[model samples]
Target: MAVAATKEPNRLILFTDAVVAIAVTLLVLPLVDVVPEVAREHRPATEVITGHQPEIWTFLLSFAVIIRLWLSHHKAFQHVRAYSTPLVLCNSAWLLAIVVLPFPTEMVGVFDNSRFTTGLYIGTVFVATGLQAAMYLIIRIDPEVASEDTPLPGEFVLGAVTAAVLLLLALVVALTVPGVGYWALLLLLLSGPVEWAWRRRHAVAAA
Candidate 1:
């Protein structure tokens, strides 16, 4: 008799998707309190919208970042056949940071001038990126969990670690240079493309 081959559910991917969706939706919840009178009295609807503009920027940036993070995780995890307890726990830590981003976004919008506020926001992103890096390390150590033919790419691993380190550095820089930190966010947003470019350059050189 042949033994049955069981398929493991990619629970991390599913849970991450659910949490990201909820977090993105929660980002908009802060805007619901701007009543009609508040809009009219504060300024026109447009100005009121614009006044809370940081909220919009933060929400959009955070939402898109979270979505992209999930996409990357999904791609990376596709190689994995099973996850260990530590990997799952590290992922949860990452998700905790993701879920907490909204609080910092709201705080920054409320007190955009506060240095500590910006630090907190950047710190949250740093923590998320760090956990993601940790997860990658665990996956690399246990290639047996990965698909046999889909060995993790060296470029992918390098890129993940580089981006995580850059994010951590950006968090530290944010403490002194808040404006630079915002610009760094734009740079961090381009990590995927940067990683692709790096791999392409290496391939061309090898050829």
Candidate 2:
């Protein structure tokens, strides 16, 4: 049996990290500066924020979704010790999705409950999650690119499955109840606790 050769591409991971960082940074762009007269003339601070509920939702949802993707990206790349051209290209597509996120956030800020806005937001998340899944497959396919400390096969599968489930849940909520789809953002925010508890139980059982 012949072992697959590993070729280290130095810039791919660094480029990927930079793109992810920028994506996360842009998530907060929906926050706008409040004019002094607007605050003093219209209503109190709480009411002013309430007037900007859509923008607030946009910021919160985009922030949560970006963070979720970034964490998964961090996890995936942490195990990967090297990269190939195709993997780099796929990752670029993934980052392209990241770049797109703010547009949907803008849509949400303007037309939060509109079907079009909800659909666009859900679609972006679905595509991003799918891309992340593809990255997982690329790493799994070329074992030589990953380090010995890479996540085990079962753990990898579990992480991928969880991401898919989260994406699907977001989509379902958008389709069935667009009004509640924004709350699905909260679902992703709460996922860390749920996964942690599940892992703790499994660890105890294994022990």
Candidate 3:
């Protein structure tokens, strides 16, 4: 049988980091453009920030989201020394979702809170989180990607899956619940407890 080829993960990790940095930076450009308008109107410097509260809020939220996603990606790949074709494809799709996040984030500030805008923002997050979860699962199952001596922890895999599930739940609540808006994302807080319970249950079962 012909063995599949695998390469070191360094270049892939570097490229992913670069793309995530650019995406996070893009989230702030809309807010920066507001400064020129504030100056052109001879408005007080205070208004430069105070008047663009929506833009600023969206920028901060998306910045945090991207950062969290990047951290998750980092953790998922931490033990992965080799990259297969499937892992590369999955990581590329995850990056594409990260790149697209800034657009909906900008729209959230420009448009009134509604089903479509809320859905779009939450949906983008859902896709990104879901992809990250898939990466965790892939690394756990693919012997070529992670060394047997340093396999991904079952808790980390469960946490990633739990987070993705919570994000999906948040997306559904945001879309179906009237006036919920971004508040639906609070559902993510349950991820810790949920993952804990799942892990504990499995441990007990094995015992």
Candidate 4:
């Protein structure tokens, strides 16, 4: 029991990392539809492969995004000194979001420039961010598993929430416009500055 108790955090991180790694691997697999059956019948494989530049770019973009999430997960786990059943459950929910990332990425690759696929991709990010932020908050909420260090997890939590709201606003642009919905993701770039200002405000008020 003591050995298991001491190793809980390690187990969580290991499992989460494995899941994230698999998701990242799958993120690129959809792009490999380089030579479709039709293309094989009509043209050389080389020419058909060259035609998938857009899919390649999409895979690169999605791989970068999911890696960012993985980094965020690592950073959040750094402050976690222990865990409990609730923490495990909450982290499971967050991991579930991460695991689903490759699906929408593949969907976006298959679908035309439609609101449904773009929105689905963006919505996946929003949910993953929200659940991640909630995971950090859960550590703070239940004192039974909290460590001596408070982890100031709100930094990551609020940062993700801020980006999610920005994504929401950007989705409006997506709905109103056409062929430009993905551009809305750029709004997430504001998260760093927003989180900085938020932390500063709290630091000042607490002083």
Estimate the Cα RMSD of every predicted model relative to the unseen true structure: 4.4, 4.8, 1.5, 3.2
State which candidate, 3 or 4, has the greater lDDT. 3
Clashing pairs in model 3?
none
lDDT of 4 by residue, 165-206 (tens): 877777777767777879888877887888888889989999
Candidate order by decreasing lDDT:
3, 4, 1, 2
Over the full model, what C-alpha lDDT does candidate 4 score relative to the true structure? 0.75
Better of 1 and 2 by lDDT: 1
lDDT per residue for candidate 2 within 1-207, as digits (tens), equals: 212235564577678778877877777655645445456686677754777777786688678778878877777777777777667777889889988998888888877577777878878887887788778887777766666775435465456656667777877777787367566655565556666777889999999
Worst ten-residue run, lDDT, model 1? 1-10
TM-score-wise, the better of 1 and 4 is 4
Q: Is candidate 1 or candidate 4 better by lDDT?
A: 4
Compared with the true structure, all predictions reach lDDT values of 0.74, 0.72, 0.87, 0.75
Q: Model 1, 126-185: lDDT tens per residue?
A: 888778878887777765455578766665577777788778776777667746646555
TM-score of 2: 0.74
Candidate 1 achieves a global lDDT of 0.74
Give the Å shift of residue 55 in candidate 4: 1.1
Better of 2 and 4 by lDDT: 4
Residues 86-144, candidate 3: write the lDDT tens digits.
Answer: 78888999999999999999999889587899899999988988888888888888888
Tell me, by lDDT, which candidate is best: 3
The true-versus-predicted C-alpha distance at residue 54 of model 1, in Å, is 1.7
Residue 67 deviation, candidate 4, in Å? 0.9
Ranked by TM-score, the better of candidates 2 and 4 is 4
